[model samples]
Target: MTNFDPAALPAAAFEPISELGPLSRERIKTRLDARGYNYAIDSDGDIGGRWDDHIFYFLLLGKDSEYLQVRGRWSRTLPASSLGQLLVLANEWNAGRIWPKAYVRTEENETLGVYCEHSVDYEPGLTDAQLDQHLGCAISTSLAFFSSLDEQFPEAVAAAKEEIARLTAEQQ
Candidate 1:
């Protein structure tokens, strides 16, 4: 037998998943793949991908995988000294927006890590359109929050601009 490489297959090669019901890892993978997003499945089976430098994970959690969560970690970290600033930013985002529940956590490295999550129970299952809306809203809202960070903490994220510019130039 030959070594099977899943990555070699075309996006269209995956089985058409028209009959959507419950939210499962495969459904998430199919949606991501169909949308041409680059993602990876971890050893624990969590599906994750990067967008504009931020990292997001699509997960189904529960005894029957009855819950769907799209969690994101902001790419920037601030010194613990900026805890107040981080908290204010998180609170502002939370107050103004609804899709992502944004917050900041004190990391072991003496820095503050930002996170955003959108989760819902899918006990009754979901249609493909519903899944698409959830996934799209999760990502777009999270990115909007990240962009707000870039705006509010420009000094902390200045390097991100340069790096993104470099990446964009390289793509051209």
Candidate 2:
């Protein structure tokens, strides 16, 4: 392997970043606002936004709140009958992808919910650039998986899509 010197690298090879700090909701909001994306604050003080008929939440977890979890839920909840099929799909997705760990969960009413999550720990902290990379990876990868689900579950999602559309309009 060729030995590479970090200091010898061109400055242009790197992007400037702000001082590292613990990831916070404010930082998340800053990035979202910068993109001019519409978002909402839940009654629980969680931050979330919708894209392509799906909802995603930017959450800080861990004992010290040092982990960032960007999570998304599919637009539709599958009937109980689909649980077995969904489990297979989730397993296949996890086996094939590196980002966005896909999984299925049973809701209280026995329906199945498909979720995609990309979580990373930053115990030391993170810079603005690193945070942006996390956000981008979380969103793009999750969307890729969601798009596959859309194709696979068109009949299931069609009704949910209409409901979400109606709710979105009502909010407006």
Candidate 3:
């Protein structure tokens, strides 16, 4: 059996919703608005955007777990947008389906504000037999998704890696 040390892992960093920038935030808001979603932005830096029937919250962390929530229930299922796609890709990476290689890039045309790409890799302690059964289930689900969406999965994974790389480069 492999000895696992969760403590050796690095702490997860919280990415501020504001880091997406006003323009990006506005774009998301506008999209939801056009879809007839009810949302509001307050002085406290909280943004709640909703469409269909789902609501998601984006909050700014403070003394309280400040966050902004955007929620909506979809009348019909919808394809995941760029952001949604990235999120799924990130989840897959975290689950060990894909390597955690990603970078961010900004286009000169300004049409695409920021983009990312990610590679695939096998994660240790993630697939151990002794690991939680739920974890195995989650990873299996992710793998099944990638298997079913063969073509799209590679593209999405690549984009995730690119986005991560771009973000890292920008910091330097």
Per-candidate count of clashing residue pairs (backbone under 3 Å): 0, 0, 47
Q: Residue by residue across 38-82, what tens digits does model 3's lDDT show?
A: 768877655664322223343333233322222211111213345
* lDDT against true structure, model 2: 0.87
lDDT of each: 0.88, 0.87, 0.38
lDDT string, candidate 2, 22-107, tens digits: 78899989988887878999998889988887899999899988999999998788889998888888899999888899999989
Checking candidate 1 for backbone clashes, the offending pairs are none
Error of 3 at 71 (Å): 16
Tell me the RMSD of model 3 versus the true structure. 18.8
lDDT of 2 at 38: 86
Question: Which tens-of-lDDT digit does each residue in 1-172 have in candidate 1?
Answer: 9899998999888765565487889888888888999999899989999998899999888889999999999988788998998889889888987779998998888988899999999997888888988999999999999888888888778766677889999999
* Order of quality (lDDT): 1, 2, 3
> Lowest lDDT 10-mer window, candidate 2?
12-21
Better-scoring candidate (lDDT), 1 or 3: 1
